[model samples]
Structure formats: structure tokens, C-alpha cells
Target: MKENQHLVHHDATTKTRHGQPSTSPTSIVFNAQPFGGGPGATLTAVMPYLRSRLKSLGPIALHYVGSSLTMDFQKLTETKWDGIHNVDLYTNPEIGKRKLVSLLQHLKPQLVVTAMDELVAAAAQAAGIPVVIIDLLLWFWPSISPNWRQAELVIAAEFYGVQERIISENLNNVATVPPLGPPARTTQDPSADVLLNFGGMINPLMPKQEYIAYSHLIYSAARRAIELRNAALPESQHAKLIVLVASFDVAQGIDPKDPEAARMVLPDEALKLMASSELTFCTAGLGNLYAAGAVANAVLLLPPLHEGHAIQTHLIQKAGVPVDAIEWHELTGRAPIDYYRDSLQVMDNVSKAQSEVIDSPQAQTALVGRMLAAMLRSASAGVSAEDPPLRTLIKEFGQDNGDAMAVQIMDVLEKVR
Candidate 1:
């Protein structure tokens, strides 16, 4: 029988890849934009709430299609993912779309969940399957409205200036929700001075050497900044820095003498450390931005690693978030306003914009100085407000939307089941 035929009696005939009788009454295919850590963080936040609701339905088959880098997050350590498809393997867009559709037909999942991936959302829609999209960067997606409208539900993680932007009224499927992030910690750990994070530090647009180069720059700058800060303080009041590593390649290059420099932490563990630390030094990825904003007392942004990071940093700064950042244009002799405008034009090709910045040795050296300066400024300012900028961004973004999206997922599944 042809694979598409399974759709007619999907639940009844659905079997594991091994061809054994299937135990799951419902099946779901999940895909997230494989570029950075944000998608994986979004998925991690929603799963527990989603699985709690699925208990009554017995076992549910889960398959994921995205970059292998996402798996390195170690968030879903306990999840029994039935199949894994590395979307990065299909470098050709047309071929990837066809393969995705074929996978959907063969799996015959009742529903599909995608985060910031237009390809997966569209492919599942073409296969006549229901789709739920978790839109982390709502402010930047106006250009791709038609493509994403194909989804049955689009959950937008809220930010400060979302109301100021014009959204398409024709796209009524959109659901506004709080910034999705790991749960907040009740107790703060004050021992750690800074949590240095570069996010999942891998993207399609840049080569491995560039990533490693940028990573080393950030790592070195953060270390030097901590050394300067600790120099003035008493020996007993010295600060500690911890780096979050998401890739083995990135981890291997970190200083081995400092064990904390390359700790591969799970999502929740990262969040806990972020809360405990006095400051978070990282890139401007929406996932980590919202998370650090939601839980950390203070945040200092490194330069943009890609177009998305640059755009997000611009938006947050414009909204008056008060977070300090090392702007890319400052180092490259370009105007910030001009860079933001150009980034919008080549937003889809994130790596293209990144290549321009990464290829410059002067920019890399200047970035280190900027990173140290921002850290010193943050250290001197100290978080005094009852609501710091990071906390305020989270408060404005609203409460956790994980449970709410899980409810929406259950409703969609009920209709399909």
C-alpha cells in the first residue's frame, strides 16, 4: 500500500517504524527552526504541560524533525522520541519539503507542532495535517504571514512593542502568549557572578571556524571582565563565572582548567543557574533574551551572531528595555539604524548578514573591549530596582504560556482525534 493511504485510517493502522503493532492512539510530529537555542527552549517549556494532558489518551508517538544541534540541549532527556529526522541533511529546500510531506504521510500523525519553521508548517499543511506553531519572534514575522497562516494555531510569545506593530487581521489563527521559557526559580543562587551563554552557537550560514572564533572571543572577554571586577573586591568577595555549553565542539575549546567554563547544562539547570547568578552575559537570541529577562536580575548582550539576533536586540533596545549591549555596527563603522534596516531585507538568510560581521578581525577585537565595557557598566550600576529591566520585560510579556499552549494543543487534538 502507498504511504499516503495510511492517512485514511491513521490512528487505527499507525505502527512503529519496526512494523510492530502501534500502542499510541495519537501521534505528533514536531519541528523547530534549527538555527539557535530558542526553538529547543520553547519546546522544552511546553512538553511537560502537554504530556500531562496526554496521559488519558495512553501512549502517544512523538517524532522530531530539525537540526541535530537541537538535540544537544539535553532538555528532553526523558522523552521517548519515536523518530528523529535531521532537517539539516536536506540542503535543498524543494527536496526537504517533499521528504517532510512524505514523512508526515507515512507517520500519519494526528497533529504537527512547529516553532519558527515555515518549511515544516507548510509541509504538514500540504499533507492535510493540523499544525500548531510557536512563534517566538512575533515582531519579525510580518514578511512570512501568508506562509505561517497555513497553521491551524499560531502561538506568539509576547514582547514589549508587539502592540505597536501592525499584525495581519486576516490571520486570525494567531494566539498571543507570554514569553516561553523554563520555569522561574523560587530561590536565587548568589554565589555565581555571571552566567556566560552564547546560545546553541550553530547556524547554517556560518562555517565551524567562525563559530569557534566568535565563541572564543566572547569567552575570553567574559573571563577578562570577571577578572577586572574581582580585582577590586576582597578575596572572599571574589566573583565566579560559569559558561553554558550546548555543543561538544564549542565545549572542547573552552579552558579545561576551569571546569565550570564548559558545563553542559540542561535547560532547567541553565535557568536555575541564570537566576542564581548576578548577571547574564549572552547574545540577543529571543529565547535566551526572554529567559534571562524573565528570571535573571541583570543581562549584558554580546554582539549579534546572526540577523535575528541583531533584529531582536534592536527591538528590545527601542522598547527601552535598559539592557546593555555591544552593538555590531559600533565595531564595524556602520550606523546601527542602517544595519537594522538592511537586516530586515536579508532576514531570511541570517548567515549572509553574519558573514559580513564574522569576517572582520577588527570587529572581533573591538567586540571583546565592548563586552568588557558592558560588563563593567552592569557591575557598577548594580540591580537596585524592585523590577529590573530583565524582570520587567518578562512581566510585560505576561506569565508563562506553556500550560495555555498545552490546553490549545489538547483542544486541537480533540477535534482531530
Candidate 2:
């Protein structure tokens, strides 16, 4: 049967002596953009795992496409690439498309891997290269929608157990990979206190009343946690309550240079202040989650998103992190004051739940290894490698601590099944 050619574009020169255009048996190019927020941090944290995965592919040239605004990609570019192109595709899809088309024509990658960016995928498919779409979050945007039927494969984090069902129903090829925990950070004492952090661009459609209400809810929740801790513990032993608000530099309906508009938005100094706190209270977004995970335990207060909020929430909770559900109404009203008064009870419940499921570091490393293995296996299958030895590659990358991490990942996978 002819493959579904709609999703990928192919060159007229169909046959090559080697797997790819060059002498190399197989070549894959990864097109990843910088994640703007918590998801970005999650992606950044998983870089080690990704690097390990790339190593498993054996001297394959990996090209990461990203914006110039973030410097994180600088270290990645030091490695030799068949080619490297940096452009703000997310901000300017038209220019991105033109540049990406040029890259595909020049690189002729056998496989292209990306998070769901439809324009890039469509272009790759138009070039006849197989595309793999990783849906990092549960939500789907109409603008950059995935055409699963056209994609060679689709991979999603295991936190979205339902995704397998969704994909099976909608797409021909699909796989579910477990959440590889955030990349390791410098060790520090996990803060004993509760921390809160929230982020996202304020919705322009959201009325001024709505923003005020949301801020009020957060304030009330923080105040309540404080009251509960103080009342439950002796004044000396009470845990500190810290609130960090990581606001987007962009504001709704505001001019960039307007001081008054800037004042209306949350300040950078405020975010720094919040980061310094022991605990963070914030809505569920990638930036806030990573910041919390990077520094301390968090009390994740998820805000509603049109899509993917539930999946994101599940991943956060599954990581053995503490989280609480505060209704939009509660946040908008002063009722959170009373809620915080009862926070000691709520926090205790969350803490207990977190302790039971938090995977050990060894387990996390193994999970990371497994995810890389799966991606490599998929890539190998597409390129028709003869039983490639990925295990050895993983060990070479220093992930062979033991089968403990793999065992833990399998256990989680089974539970999801």
C-alpha cells in the first residue's frame, strides 16, 4: 500500500544507495522551538534526556530550530550540524515557513520530529519527509492543528492516558510515552514551606474585573495558607507562605512604551521576589511549574485553559507534586480568605498525597531513558534500521545506573494501561 503521502512531501529522486541522500544510513533532524513558559521549562529540563536520545541514534546530526530571543539554544548550536537555522518561527510563521522549506531542501532529513506545529509539519510532509508530532500539552489549538492521519506517528506524554484513545480514534499511527521528569537541577534543600506561582498572558477578552478577581483569589489563598500554618504550628515553627507571579512581558491592549500600561501589568521585580520565596502559589502553566520544580515544592493552582489544562494538571500531580483546586469563583471573591484559614487541613492532605507517589531520582532517570528508547525505536522503524542497538547507546550516554528506573517506568505504564 502506498503510504499516506498527504502529510509529507517527497523528492522525485526516490531511490538512494544509502538510507538518506548522503552516504549515512539514516539521518534525522529535530525541529524544536523554545517553549515560552512552564512547558518550555519542562522541555528544557528534559534536554538531557533528549541529548541522550540523540546519542542513541549514533552520530546523527540534530538541528534544533528556535527563536533568537532565548539564549538557551546557544549551547546546543556549538555541536556541528549538517546545518543550523535560527529564526522566530513562532512569531513570524511566514518567514519561518520560507526558511524551513529551504532547510528541508538542503538537509533532506529522513525523519522530522517536532511538537505540534502544523505549518512546519505540513511543509516537511510536502517535502515527503516523515514527521513525528509530540503533543506536549493536552490542548489543541486550531491555528497549528495536527493532521494525525497525515503524520507518520504521534507521541504524547503518558499523563494523558486518554490520548491513546483519542489518537486511535483519529490517527493511523500513535504512541504514548511517559512523562520524563524535569531535567535535573542543582541540588538544594527542597523547601519545607509551601510556595505558590502563577503565570500566563492576561486575556484581552477578560474584563478588568476578571483580572482583579483572579488576583484577589490568589491573594486570599495565600493569606489563608498563612493563617492555617500559623494557627496549626507554634509561631516559631510555622512555614513561610510565599507568592510568585510570573507575568508575561506582553500585556493585553497595552502599548509597549507606556509606563502607565506597564504599571497595570505585573512587574519583573515582583516575579523575582516571588521566586525568592520558599513556596509558590500559581496557576498551572509550564513556566510556573518549572520555576517551582527548579527551586521548591509548589502548591499548583491550575487555571482553566480552552484545552490541555486537565492533561497538564495530571502530569503535575503524577510527578508527586502538591496541588490544589481553587475555583475561578473562589479566586474572584474574598472567600479564599476563609479557605486559607482552613489551609492547614488542605495542605496536609496534599503533602501526604505527594509523598506516596514521588518517584525516586533513580526512577526518574530510568523513565527518561525509556522515553528516549521509545523515540529512537520509532525513528529506527521509519528509517528501516536492522534492529539498532539503542540500549548500548543509552549506557554510553551514562544512563545505565540500573534497570530500577526502567522498572519504575514500566510500573507506571502498566498502571496507566
TM-score for each of the candidates: 0.82, 0.49
User: Which candidate tops TM-score?
Assistant: 1
Question: Which residue ranges in model 2 land beyond 4 Å of their true spot?
Answer: 1-27, 33-58, 68-84, 138-146, 160-164, 167-170, 182-194, 198-278, 286-307, 310-323, 333-417
- Kindly give the stretch of ten consecutive residues in candidate 2 with the minimal lDDT sum: 387-396
Give the residue spans of candidate 1 off by over 4 A: 1-24, 74-76, 161-169, 182-189, 253-260, 332-334, 341-369, 374-385
> In candidate 1, what residue range of length 10 has the lowest lDDT sum?
6-15
lDDT of 2 by residue, 1-417 (tens): 333231223211122222333444344555553443332223334433444544434545445554431223333223333334464566567877787787677666767766555566788888888777666553333232555557766665433234645654564455555443323232233333444444442332233344344444334434554554456555554555444432323222223343233221132333444434434455655444433443322233444331233335554457444455433222232222212223344333332322221223442233223323322232222222221121121122222121322233223323322
- The local lDDT score (0 to 100) that residue 253 gets in candidate 2 is 24
TM-score of 1: 0.82
Cα misplacement distance, residue 114 of candidate 2 (Å): 0.4
lDDT string for model 1 (1-417, tens) is 234233333222222345424454467888777677778766766877887888887778667677656766533355445556655433678866766676777778999998877777777777788888888776675465665667778877777545444354455777777777655433333553778977777775556666776777678767776787777666765677788867766777666555446767777678878887777888788778877876776678877766677677777778777778776567777645334455434443433434555677776567656655655655665445455576656656666748987887788788888
